[model samples]
Target chain A: MKAFKESILCAGHGGQGIVSMGKLLAYAGMQAGYQVTFFPSYGAEVRGGTAHSMVRIQYPEAIANPVITHPTVAIIMNKPSLDKFLGRIAPGGVLLYDAAAAEKIPEKTGVTIKKIPCTAIALKLKDKRVANMAALGSLSKIKGLFSLQELIQCLPFIFSGKQDLIEKNTEALRQGFNEV
Target chain B: MTPAKKILITGNEACGEGAVTAGCGFYAGYPITPQNELTAYMSKRMDECGRVFIQSESELAAINMVLGASLTGERAMTTSSSPGISLMQEGISYLAGCQLPAVIVNVMRGGPGLGNIAASQADYFQATKGGGHGDYNMVILAPAGVQEMFECTYEAFDIAERYRNPVMILSDGIIGQMMEPIEVRYPQKSVDPDKSPWALRGCKGRESRSIRSLFLKEGALEEWNRDLQRKFRTMEAKEVRYETYKTGGARLIFVAYGTSARICRAVVDKLRQEGVKAGLFRPVSLWPFPYKKLKGLDKGTTVFFDVEMSAGQMLYDVRLAVADDSRVLFHGRMGGGVPEEADIINIAKKAVKRK
Candidate 1:
């Protein structure tokens, strides 16, 4: 396959596992033989404030400039994130957002928008914290960049020793994937 | 040769792993933002490896502990951010003066005093120049990527031992917090304190020795200073390291280091696509400065554009190396602001289009 690059941005309020979602994506990309970089916003705002992470994956080549000014894919998990990063998506890029949290999303020219009901799906799984994973599931389904199995395999490493949480998160990911 | 297994890790963790792989037996550090991951990694990793890890009460104590460990001939290290590194300057001077082999990792944050936890190259002057009070120079290595973070730190120990001087791995918050895939590798031989002649290993079988920087005797201090200067001159001649990207027959070169260098590389790629002959000159060893190589790159027509996260700290060195102020231009962002690729591209375009 020809070398391809994807710059992804995951943004949400703190405690929503936005950084974890970005790590999962980058780890999956690395597993698929792609050079990847995951950069998280490190500041006092890490607690109950706006948080975001940037992940760039390039196949068969190293990634330069890990910071994404214009993202190829923006995963906005809440209203604040949608409001902040909506206009920064590249033309012809994909925006997968939480439909229940980010209400009345604005339309952007030349951008593909997929409104995934991420929070509602996580609520159905009996845990609303997995909303980031649900949104990530929709992202994978939309982009087809990494398979569901690849993402699932990363759970054991990311959420080590949390067997029950892993099971629920896996189900949440599957629900989000099937919903898309 | 066995192929190393690639693992996903943050820059901070990678530096810790590098130190561990280089047979670092002693690590002492205080918790600081951006660089806290390294201390945390060492806490667990050192325990697993049956080594020593200390969460010192302060940066002052931490650096002194490293000095103690180095005196005992253990491969030792300490890490911190900008302000914390400032606190350890006195200890650094002591290490340099005593001719000790030790590694210091500075994951620089924006700073004049207790600056916010944001990525900045503002500490370039502090790292390359003598941050502490002395006529001492520490070998400074600035790694631009996650893999180099590991590799540079791993090599820093050898460089320190080779020169019997303090060596610094000067990194920033961006590289510290960012995560990338890296293949970890170990050195062939671990550090053996008994092999060092100056090591204070009980001194039972050998004559008693002493290691101190305080020279109260007349002319003794001057003689020691001369020896230190000679070592520094030898380091300047032998230890300069840098990387050149696409500079072959290029009309413009971006001189940058660390995180800014990576962004400049992206700018070079974009400019090349636009038919502009742009390249990058990244100084891996900030102390040695690569003066001769930088001067050699000037063909009278090539304009050297220097970029940094600071307000042109390294620009002075570039100007001094090039010897002509007209041939050097600078673009920088201070107080934790990072220069974007678009801005650099615009600046480069204007520079290339100028008469």
Candidate 2:
């Protein structure tokens, strides 16, 4: 098979589940048959700091470092994450931001900008905590990195013990997908 | 692509899974950054595995606990990062001096006293060069990916038992923290201290075998050193492990190991597409050094580029192994920084320009 390489960076705060978003994407990406690597910041890199995760997916290949220098896609969950990563998106790449939470993002050219109000969508879904899921839905919609069916099927198992929230999260993802 | 039995897990979790797959029965460790997931994984799984897990009060206690268990002939292990590995140095030296079999993993973080939680391979001098004291060698296995972490950790117990010396899985925070999909296949062999003739488990109706490092008599320590050197020599002959890619016709050889090796691989692929004949030589075993692999190069055409995460720790070894000072070029970063593919490609271009 021909080589297909993609890297994504997700940045947000400590309790925002930004890391979980990377995990879910990686899991789904692997199921879609991509060699995936996810690197999460911890300790001094994130303790009382702006945390981020770099997820690299390669078709029929293994990637080194898992440290993405220029991400093909940047998923911003907050203002600081946007400020820190806005310039790092590759030319003609995509930047998805939670418009409900972030301030004005600096002007940029070439990169596609998708301003999804993930928090607003999640709020309408009755849980602002699922903003990450909204963003995840928008990401899959934009990138087509994984199938929606696979992502939906994996949710209950990913949140295996939490039977109560699976349906709500599935709804959040669907609403977020429709928002796109 | 038909996927293998893919299970995505952090590097540290893979290490824990490997330990269990290898049938390790004793785990004692203090939680530290990057490697904490390993301790937590073992903590949860050891009970189910019918093994022992002790979150020791300190790294010293943890390694000593490993030593205590190693004496009974159980496959024992301890996990730690740089600073904690430093704390376990005396125990490491003791493990070596007493010649007890055990596994130690240095999921290395930035160091020189609690530097940061970022990953670094600066401990190359420490892990492969003998951190504690005396003339000792740990069969150091460097795992570049999560799969290697699982397989190397699984194989470590067997190596430790076979050599009657400590085996180390020298990993860094990057690979330790990175999550990847892997296929894990565990071996069926289980380590039992009771099977070893040197085991200290109750000299029941038999002559006791004492294990200690103290030998104050004239030339006794010398004889012990001789014995250790003999084992080192044997390891040099039998334990060397490495992998090479596209080197048969390449003019530039990127010599590296661990995470740096993977980055070099990506660079090599890119350069190969760009019409630059670049190759990669990755050492899987650091202690054995794989010095012979650097030989038989087309001397007139090849230039070796030594890449590392630390500020050129492995460069010295590369130069020594290549035995040609003029051909080795060094580029690296430290304090938990990693070199990207672009950076290495630029370095390679600059190196080519100089000569």
Best by TM-score: 1
Q: Model 1 lDDT vs. the true structure?
A: 0.91
Interface RMSD of each: 3.7, 1.8
Indicate the docking level reached by candidate 2.
Answer: medium
- Which stretches of candidate 1 lie above 4 Å from their native place? B1-4
DockQ (C-alpha based) per candidate is: 0.60, 0.71
The true-versus-predicted C-alpha distance at residue B102 of model 2, in Å, is 0.9
lDDT of 1 by residue, A84-178 (tens): 89888999999998887666777899999999999999999889899988987887788999888889989877897599989988998999899
Score candidate 2 by DockQ.
0.71
Please provide, for model 2 over A62-141, each residue's C-alpha lDDT reduced to its tens digit, 9 standing for 90 to 100.
67657888899898888877877888899878999999755556668999898999988887877877898888888778
Model 1 alpha-carbon miss at residue A40, Å: 0.9
TM-score of 1: 0.98
Clash number for candidate 1? 0
User: TM-score for the second chain in candidate 1?
Assistant: 0.98
What TM-score do all the candidates reach, one by one? 0.98, 0.96
Q: For residues B219-249, could you state the per-residue lDDT of candidate 2 as single tens digits?
A: 9999999998999889889998889988988
Score candidate 2 by lDDT: 0.86
